[model samples]
Target: MTPGARVAAAIEVLDDIEARRRPAADALKDWGLSHRFAGSKDRSAIGTLVFDALRRRASSAFIMGVETPRAIMLGAMRQVRGMSVDEIAALCTGQAHAPSTLTEAESERLASADLAGAPVHVAGDFPEWLEPSFIAVFGEAAVAEASALAARAPLDLRVNTLKGTRDKALASLAHLQPQPTPLSPLGLRLPLTSDGRGPALAAEPAYVKGLVEIQDEASQLAALLAAAKPGEQALDLCAGAGGKTLALAALMQNKGQIYATDSDGRRLMPIYARLERAGARNVQVRPQRRGGEGLSDLEGRCDLVLVDAPCTGTGAWRRNPDAKWRVRPGALDQRIADQDQALVEAARFVKPRGRILYVTCSVLREENEDRLAAFLAAHPEFKSLPARDMAEQAELPGLVAFASRFGEGLRLTPLTSETDGFFIAMLVRS
Candidate 1:
C-alpha cells in the first residue's frame, strides 16, 4: 500500500477506536481481518501510524483546533513524523484510498501551529486530569517527563541466568544488534525498527532455548532490587505470568525455592510454559482461587515476599499510549485498593527480619510513596528500608543516587532512569 493509503487506513482505525471507545489493538485487528488484501508491511505501517497518532493525540488536537480522526492524523504527520505542510498535502491528494485535501484552516494551522504556549497536558500529550499527579512527582520537569513517556520505547530482554549468561545470550542474538542495558546486569536492548515495531525476539533460537526473556529494564531492575540470594526462600504474591518470578529464580541460580501465585489463577497459566522455557526449576507454581489460602503452608516463612502490585500503568505510556487516555479516576482508585490488599497479604509471608519488595509500574505519587506510607502506618512491625542501602547491599550501588530521591524507595522513570516508570520500596519485618 502507498503511504497515503496507509495514512487513510490509520485514520479509519482511529475513528473506529474513538466511536466505540474500544482498544486500538482490537480496532486494528478487526480492520486487518476484514481487509485481507493488506500485506504484513502495510498492516505494520498502519498500526504504527495509529499508535503514534494516539501518543500525540492531545497535542495534535490542540494544534489543529479539532479532534477528528483526520485532524489527528494530519497533526501527527507534522508533529511526530516531521512532515511539512507540502509533504502532508502530497499524501492527501483526494486520490483513490487517499484522504481528502486539507481545508484552508487546517493548512494555515499546519503552517503556523506551535506548542510553545500550549498547556502542560497538551504539550505533554497526556490527560488533563493527570497534570497534578505529574507535577507532584516531577514539579517543573513534569511536562518534560510526560513528553518522554509519550516517546517510543526500546525493546528490552533479560538473559536467563538459570539457562545461560548475558554474554552468551547476547552472542546468540547478535543478529538483532542487541546492546547491553545501561543498568541491568543481565539485560540486553534492541532498538525499535524505523516503523516503531520491535523485532520478533520470541521466534529467535536463543529465546526458544531459554536464553532471554522479553522484559522492560525497569522490571529487571525491580527484581534486582529485591536482592533475592541463592538458597533464600522467595515468594511472588502477585506473580502474574511470573515475569519477576522467573527473574527471581534466575537470580537465585536455581538453588532456592520460589513460590509463585496470583489472586487470578488464569493469569498464572502462561507462567508454566515460560518457567519451563527458561529452565527455572526452583519455581513452584501455586495458582490461587479467589479467597483461597493457596500459600497457607508457607505463611511467615519466606525470606522475601515480592508484591508487584497493580497500578494505573502511567509509566508504560510509551508502549501503550491509548491506555493513557482511557484510564479513569475510578480505575486508579480501584488499583490503589488492590495494591493495599496485595501488600497486606504479601506481608503475611515475610519471616521476621525478612523483606517485602513493594513494586508498581506507576509514576503517580498516590500509588507509590503514598501507598508505602499508608502500609508502614498500618504495619508497625515492618519498617521501611532505605532503597540506597538495599541497592548497595545487592552490589548495585549505581542505583543509590537515583533511589535516594524518593527517600524510602526507588522510582524509575523514562526521563530519569531511561526505563519504564517503576517504584520499588523494600520493607523489613522487625
Candidate 2:
C-alpha cells in the first residue's frame, strides 16, 4: 500500500477506536480482518501510524483545534513524523485509496501551529486530570517526564540465569544487534524498527530455549531489588504470567523454593509453559482455589514476599499509549484498592524480619509512596526498609542514587531511569 493509503487506514482505525471506545489493538485487528488485501507491511505501517497518533493525541488535538480522526492523523504527520504541510498535502491529494485533501484550517495549523502555548497536559500528550499527579511526582519537569512517557519504548529482555548467562544469551541473539541495558545486569535491549515495532525475538533460538524473556529493564531491576537469595523461601503473591517470579528464580539460582500464586488463577496458566521453557525448577505454581485458604501453610513463614501490585500503568504509557487515554479516576481508585489488598495479603506471608517488596508500573504517588505510607501506618509491625540500602546489599549500588529521590522506595521513570515507570519499596517485618 502507498503511504497515503496507510495514513487513511490509520485514520479509520483511530475512528473505530474512538467510536467504539475500544482498545487500539482490537480496532486495528478488526480493520485488518476486514481489509485482508493489505499486506503485512501495510498492516504494520498502519498500526504504527495509529499508535503514533494516539501517543500525541492531546497535543495533536490542541494544535489542530479539532479532535477528529483526520485532524489527529494530520497533526501526527506534522508533529510526530515531522512531515511538513506540503509533504502531508502530497499524501492527502484526494487520490484513489488516499485520504481526502486537507481543509484550509488543517493546512494552516500544520504549517504554523506550535505547542508552546498549549496546557501542560496537552503538551505532554496525557489526560488533563492526570496533570496534578504528574506535577506531584516531577514538579517543574512533569511535562518533560510525561513527554518521555509519550515517546516510543525500546524492547528489553532479561537473561534467564537459570538456563544461561547474559553473555551466552547476547551471543546467541547477536543477529538482532542487542545492547546491554544501562542498569540491569541481565538486561538486553533491542531498538525498535523504523516502523516502530520490535523484532520478533520470540522466534529467536535463545528465546525459544528460554535464555531470555521479554521483560522491561525496569521490571528486571525491580526483581533484582527484591534481593531473593539462595535457600530463601519466597512467595510471589501476585505472580501474573510469572515474569518477576522467573526473574526471582534466576536471582535465587534455582536453589530456593519460590511459590507463585495469584488471586485470579487464570492468570497463572501461562506460567506453567514459561517455567518449563526457562528451566526454572525451583519455582512452584500454586493455583488459588476459589473460596479456599490461600497459602495458609506459608503464612508468616516466608523469607520474602513480592507483591507486584496493580496500578494505573502510567509509567508504561510509552508502549500502551491507548491506556493513557482509557485510564479514568474511577479506575485509579480501584487500582489503589487492589494494591492495598495485595500488600495486606503479602504481609501475611512474610516471616518476621523477612521483607515484602511492593512494586507497581506506575509513577503516581497515590499508588507508590502514598500507599507505602498507609501500609506502614496501618501495620506497626512492618517498617519501611531503605531501598538504597537494599540495593547496595544486593550488589546493585547504582540504584542507590535513584532510590534517594523517593521517600521510602525506588522510583524509575522513562525520563529519569531510561526505563518504564516502576516503583519498588521494601517493607521488613519487625
Worst 10-residue lDDT window, candidate 1: 398-407
Encode model 2's per-residue lDDT on 315-390: one tens digit a residue. Answer: 8999999999999999999999999988888888888899999999999999999999898899999998887687
Q: Which stretches of candidate 2 lie over 4 Å from their true place?
A: 404-406
Candidate 1 per-residue lDDT, tens place, 92-198, comes to 98887889898899999999988878888999999889888888788899889999998899999999987878889878988899999999999999988878899
Q: What is the TM-score of each candidate against the true structure?
A: 0.98, 0.98
| Candidate 2, run of 10 with poorest lDDT | 287-296
Evaluated against the true structure, the overall lDDT of model 2 is 0.91
